[model samples]
Target: MWIQEVGEYSKKLLDKGTGEDVVTYRRVQGGEGTKSSQQRIQVNGDGTVTIPKKDADLNISIDNGEHSNYFKNEVRGGNADIVEFDVPKWFDDFLKENTIPQSGYNSNPLNQGGTAPKLVDPTKPGNSFEVPAPWVEWIEEYAKNAQIKK
Candidate 1:
C-alpha cells in the first residue's frame, strides 16, 4: 500500500501592489518516511501564474465542469512546454485590404488580353488552375517590400 501525507503549507505575499503571491506545499511519502518541500504555486508581476510541471497534484479542465474528460491522457509523454505569440493588429487589416479574390484572379491573367489555356475535370467540383510565373514574381516582390519598415 502507498500513502501520501500533506504536511504544513505556507503562503507568502510577494508584490502586494501587483497582487503577487507564492504558495508552498510540503509532501511526505515513501515506505518508511521521506519529506520534500515543493513550490506549489507562484503569482508573477504580470499576472501570470507559474506551477511545477512534475510531481504536482493538479486538476485542469476546459470549462470547469464536473463531468469533464481527463486532459492528462492527451499529454502522451511529449514536450509539455507552452508557448505564447503576438501578432500586430495592423497585419490583419492590411491583408483584408490588399489580397485579391479568386474571382478577380480568374478574370485577369499575366498575359493580359491573350487567350489562356484551360482544362476541365469531371471529377473535380470547381475550376482548378495555377497562377502564371509573372504574377508569382510580382507577388514575391510585393511581399519583400511590404515586410520592410521605413
Candidate 2:
C-alpha cells in the first residue's frame, strides 16, 4: 500500500446544465471516493505504465489514443515529466486503509495549455507535489467558467 484517500466524500456529476431534469452531483458510496495527489508516471518497456500511488500501484497499457501518443512522443524526451521524490513511512500505512486513485480527467479534456500549472504540496519541502488529500474524487475544471482563478 503506497497511496490512500483521506477527505470528505465527493459526488459524481449527474448533469451540468440548467433544466427541469438536471442534477449536478450524486452521492458516492461510502469507502468509494476520488482524491487528488501528485503521482509518478513510469512508462514501462512492455507498452504499459506503472504509477506508484498512495492507493495502489497502477499498471496501464499504452496501446491506444492518448496513452499511445504519450508513450511515443513524450516518454523519453523533454516532454517527460521528471521529479525527485521520496516517500515517507507513515503515508504507506495510510494507503493501506484508503484509496487514492491514480488516474483522472479534466471536465473539458483538451490539450491546449501553453503553460502547465505549478502545484506543490506545501506540507513538504523542495517544490513538493504529491497527493493533496488521502482520498476524494477530484476533477480539473480548467475552463473559462472555472470557479477557482487567480
Candidate 3:
C-alpha cells in the first residue's frame, strides 16, 4: 500500500448553512527547520461570534457599562470591523467590584473641598482656588437633609 502526503495551502472558503453564511481560513506557516502555528477566527451561522469560553466569561465578569456603551456605539453606530484591547486585571477587578461612596462628594477626602467650590482672588500665581467653609457646611447640611450620610 502507498500513501500520498498533500501539501498545505492557505485559502478561505464560505460555508453555507441555515440562513447565514460562515467563512473559514486555513493558512500554512514556517519554513525549512522552523515550527509552524495556525490561528483562525470562527463565527457561527447564527451571526454570533465564536470566542474562547474563558474570554466570554471575562467579558461577562468585567461588564463595564461605559465600555459596553462604547463598544455598542463603535460596532453598531460607527460600523467598525474590529476592536481589540487589553485592560489591567486590577482594572477589571475595580470595575467589577468598586462602588461609589455613599457619602457623595461631601465626605470623601479627595472631595474635601466640598461641592461647587469657587476660586478665590489670586494671592500669588497661576491657580488660587479655595473651598469656602460656608460651601462645605452647606453641602454637608444638604447631604444630611437628603439622608445621604455614609
| Candidate 2 lDDT by residue in tens digits, 1-150 | 222222111111222332222111111111212322233343344323334443432221111123322332333332233221112223323322333222231232321121111122223221211233222112111011111100
The true-versus-predicted C-alpha distance at residue 76 of model 1, in Å, is 22
Model 2 lDDT-worst window of ten: 141-150
Please, what are the lDDT tens digits per residue for candidate 3 over residues 19-100?
3222111111121222222111223443333333212111110122233233333322332222122223332222223222
Q: In model 3, what lDDT does residue 123 have?
A: 33
Cα lDDT over the full model 2:
0.23
Q: In order, what lDDT does every prediction score?
A: 0.24, 0.23, 0.24
- TM-score of candidate 3 against the unseen true structure: 0.18
Order of models, best lDDT first:
3, 1, 2
Higher-TM-score candidate of 1 and 3: 3
Q: In candidate 1, list every pair of residues with a backbone clash.
A: none
Least accurate 10 contiguous residues by lDDT in model 1: 1-10
Candidate 1 residue 83 C-alpha distance from true site, Å: 12
